[model samples]
Target: MNADSNGLSNAEALSRLIKYGPNIFRDHHELPLLIQFLSRFKNPLTILLLVASAISAFTGEMTDFVIIMVMVISSVTLDFVQEHRASKAAESLRRSVSVCAIVIRDNKTLEVPLVNVAPGDIVLLSAGDIIPADGFVLEADDFFVKQALLTGESYPVEKKPGPLASDSIDLQSATNAVFMGTPVVSGSAKILAVKTGASTAIGAIADSITRHPPPTSFEISTHRFGLLILRLTILLVLFVLLVNALMHKPLLESFLFAVALAVGLTPELLPMVVSVTLARGAVSMARKQVIVKRLASIQNLGSMDILCTDKTGTLTEARITLQQHVDPQGNGSERVLELAYLNSFFETGLKSPLDEAILDHKNIVVDVWKKIDEIPFDFERRRVSVLVENGESQWLVVKGAPEEIIGLCTCYSVTS
Candidate 1:
């Protein structure tokens, strides 16, 4: 089938729609409410308490049964309410990352739901665009994509229209194919959507990121303690029932007495205490501008000896500001900014935070400057250079890490 700027015809798009379903990836294992509630019963302490309550009710000790039931209801209800709120918060966060994209269909470029993007559709991408689907580069101009989500490499990867001879190439080396959720670092491209939703490489990685329980030491110790208590409660209850029966006590009285012993031994109030404390902790965290997605995580967090993670969107706000531009001898210089902005503004490569900051500073009219050639930034080179021709003069501007930028200099200029 031919694919172009017009993309697939309406009939063809519809046909593929039926075949591929939608461009959406659903996390496959969301437990139902009833199952979630039932899962709480898996705890040994909860099971033992429940059994004691049943024995109390069976022996017609309605008051004891009612008291135990109240505790169980209070504990479970608090837990359920807290977890439900947390789940909703997580879903809202996910929605922000999954946004719409523009695709060409029937000769018209239109913004559509990301789910509606299908293979063979033409995706028009520009700088700062977050790619919603994987595709082959049909056309490109100095395009660079940041695939850190997939490749874990901080440097942006350049892409161009080319033929791959084999399927054995690694994803980072697949220079011709674009992946979903990666941002266009700079430049622009007309990409033909080859994979969408779960079929893309990033989608597969996301699919593998199932919500498995965190391996917290506190949880492990708590579980082991519960089992130890379960064993002790069983032995104590059995011994009491045997002794009472041997003494010719009434069966109902003996059962009731044994149930009371089990209740006392099982730490029946612990669950209620934990639930209330965790809920309070969650509220406290929210007040401090920290969102605790799982209330149970509070205990795990408290028990953490050390925790390490990315600082992006966590320790630091993602926004960056241009602080100051200066020359040698610590003198403020507009020329430093002028040169930096010109280098940033003229280059046809991926823009960095430093570049954005420089561009956002007081703008200079560059209508007379003609961009000559650009030397793109790479980790090895540690810089980007832009040469521009203005009137009868031409100047080369370079920007990069401070150490690297200084290393290339033979002389320093100090504003007097």
Candidate 2:
């Protein structure tokens, strides 16, 4: 394996792996068996039970020994199976393939499976698309994106093609960039893929989630409690054996008594309780729209102090309505608004906040005006011009950034 700057390397020549390491397949059918076997011997409660069973056997109480052993094994086995099944189901749901995207390569657009898209591919995105890769915009058509996944902003951001020069530009302010795992809420654009797989920002988050090594509070508590139980059980068994030996008890009877004491002190309920608690937490989180992919994360959520939440979908409604439009001139403001509404109504195959604002105007009737010709909105000029042949003469109406419109205007209107 060859290491990159972040110490990731290719797992195979045919497929790309994260530079950090090859992705481990989480699914393991044998996991349940392994968990059951480990749980029976490793837990303090289970250890106590095992010691008790050994004592019963030594004491010639065959039935008692058999029953205790059976209960311990059965409980661990049930927990192991239940946990494994839930994990498998969660993984299957999360990894199911849903959509494919069109990518541009060699100056041609081609449909490709989303998972197969690698770095350096150009992806063609339309309105309502979920971005497949992290990229930079190559072509944008009145493009706007909802970057709620990356930034908490609720508004759909207008995107353009150019290097934005701002020291404090947020991810949402990256007008020339698009990121992985966010959906295209409106408009269309062609994006040049800059990163893919684990190299992408979203991929990094996934890697972080996977590689987090800190044990949960519950795990820590369980380990400590189990250790304490194990030590105490060993000491008590030793004390009993010493007393029996000092009392000149028969060899076989003394051995049996020691085994019984060990079995009695083992904690057989701890593993079952832990499994049940995790399962209950998973169900509870699911009810709150938070799917628990990893069982260990259940306890971690309880200990979290700061939760970064996306503001768009999580806090606000997705729809953006025009609150109000400022018209400095009072006289022809209504006319300008009417023209703007009419032009937007007639235009087809385009969607934007400006267009939506025009269409949603309550006072204007868009069908009343007839269109003559229109100069489409250009980002370079930062304006849209429309000529409407209303009544006798044609009226040239334009609306855009106030500063840009002011420079082009020879008249003024003051709103009363």
Which candidate should be chosen as best, given TM-score against the real structure?
1
Q: Evaluated with lDDT, which candidate comes out highest?
A: 1
lDDT of each residue in 135-156, candidate 1, tens digit only: 8998988789988777666667
CA lDDT scores, all candidates in order: 0.81, 0.68
Q: List the candidate 2 regions with Cα displacement exceeding 4 Å.
A: 1-41, 105-107, 168-170, 280-290, 294-296, 299-416
Measured over all alpha carbons after superposition, the RMSD of each candidate to the real structure, in angstroms, is 5.6, 7.0
The TM-score measured for candidate 2 stands at: 0.68
Error of 1 at 391 (Å): 9.5
Lowest summed lDDT over 10 consecutive residues: which window, candidate 2? Answer: 3-12
Query: TM-score for every candidate vs. truth?
Result: 0.74, 0.68
- Cα deviation at 264, candidate 1, in Å, is 2.5
